[model samples]
Target: MSRHFYSCPLRWSDMDAFGHVNNAVFISYLEEARIDFMFRLAPGDGSPSFSGGSVVARHEIDYKRPLVHRHEPVTIESWVTKINAASLTIAYEIKDEGQVYVRASTVVVPYDLAAGRPRRITEEERMYLLKYLDDDATGTNKSAEDAEDKDALAA
Candidate 1:
């Protein structure tokens, strides 16, 4: 499966008084990357756009380390972790060459803006997401080698 990479620029204002990015600001960064992935890159061939409306049902974040403000941008690697009939989960990692600063996931539900309620994922949306679906069967989020080793042990 392929991953979507978004290079998010760090702003001086994004840092808190502690010289590290504010925890809350990380949410905004995730939103920016999600927008880029779902709207900017989502198919425009008459498919319903997420720009119409979508809500964050949940967010799970693990801050691995502090990220200080820098001139260079940090890359956020994103991929679809789970997709249900009415919602989908997008996973991410905010990282540089050396280490990851954050690992997170957001569960998003499509909304019918005019109807004012959540809607089921359309066939088009499902098909589009399938392209980026993870190949891992266990869904354990482990490295490929680790997963394989586990499978061998289980067998």
Candidate 2:
């Protein structure tokens, strides 16, 4: 599976007194990338696609390093880690200059606006998400084992 990458610009206000991007701000970056990916994959034209918006059920983030303000945009790579009957998990990495600053995942459920409840993923939606399934455990880029090996050697 190929990962979708989004280049997100950093704002000066994203920095905190500690001289690095605030931890909470990382959520915004992830949200932006997810939104962009969703819109691109399923436009708002009310097509048979997954046009129904989704709601985030959970978010988990691991901060690997602090991100300092820089002129270049931060790159967020995202891919579908798992897809279920009603929800899907998206894994993400925020990186710059080949260094990962954050690793995160979000659980999102398809929402029915008028019904004010969650709905099962449609067949079309499931098929669309299948194209992004990253079953290798290593993700869309490197393998998890390779990353662990590198970390172990570095330590």
Candidate 3:
């Protein structure tokens, strides 16, 4: 599995009074990288690919260093850590230059747009996502099967 890296510019408004990028801005960068990765794997109709509305279940961020206002370009890299029928976890490492400045993980759960519930991910999507999954990730595809099986049993 290989990670997808996206290059995004640090907006002028992204800075704060401290002369560094705001904390919330980092999540925005993560969102952009995640969206870019998903678009690469699955091109949708200009909406999120996850079935159910793809709500964020968890977000954890660790800032190793601060990004100043003068950085040239920032690179945000993301890859699947685990994929499940109802939820998917993507890990991100955001950097400027060759040094890592932030490490984060987001757990996004699938939601049924029509049924208004968590939905099981399709096998095609699961397969498409595997190409972008992290090599160090353990049991990425296998976790998805359990959610799928549970959904099957429920139905």
Q: Give the alpha carbon lDDT tens digit for every residue of 1-155 in model 1.
A: 87889999999999998999999999999999998888853556655667569999999887777899999999998888788999998988899995677888889999999999999988878887777777772323668535544654586
State which candidate, 2 or 3, has the greater lDDT.
2
Highest TM-score, which number? 2
**Which is the leading candidate under lDDT?**
2
> Which of the two candidates, 2 or 3, achieves a greater TM-score against the reference?
2
TM-score of each: 0.86, 0.87, 0.79
List runs of model 3 lying over 4 Å from the truth. 44-52, 138-155
How does candidate 2 score on lDDT? 0.84
Clashing pairs in 1: none
Candidate 2 RMSD computed on C-alpha atoms after optimal superposition onto the true structure: 2.7
Q: RMSD for all candidates, in order, please.
A: 5.7, 2.7, 11.5
Candidates 1 and 3 compared by lDDT, better number: 1
Per-residue lDDT of model 3, residues 25-50, tens digit only: 99999988887776664445643455
Cα-based lDDT at residue 9, candidate 3: 85
List pairs with backbone clashes in candidate 2. Answer: none
lDDT of 3 at 47: 38
Q: Give the range where candidate 1 is weakest over 10 consecutive residues by summed lDDT.
A: 137-146
lDDT of 2 by residue, 1-155 (tens): 77889999999999999999999999999999998876675766556455666899999998877899988999999999888899999999999786788889999899988788999998877777777789775454557635844784596
The collision pairs in model 3 are 52-111, 52-112
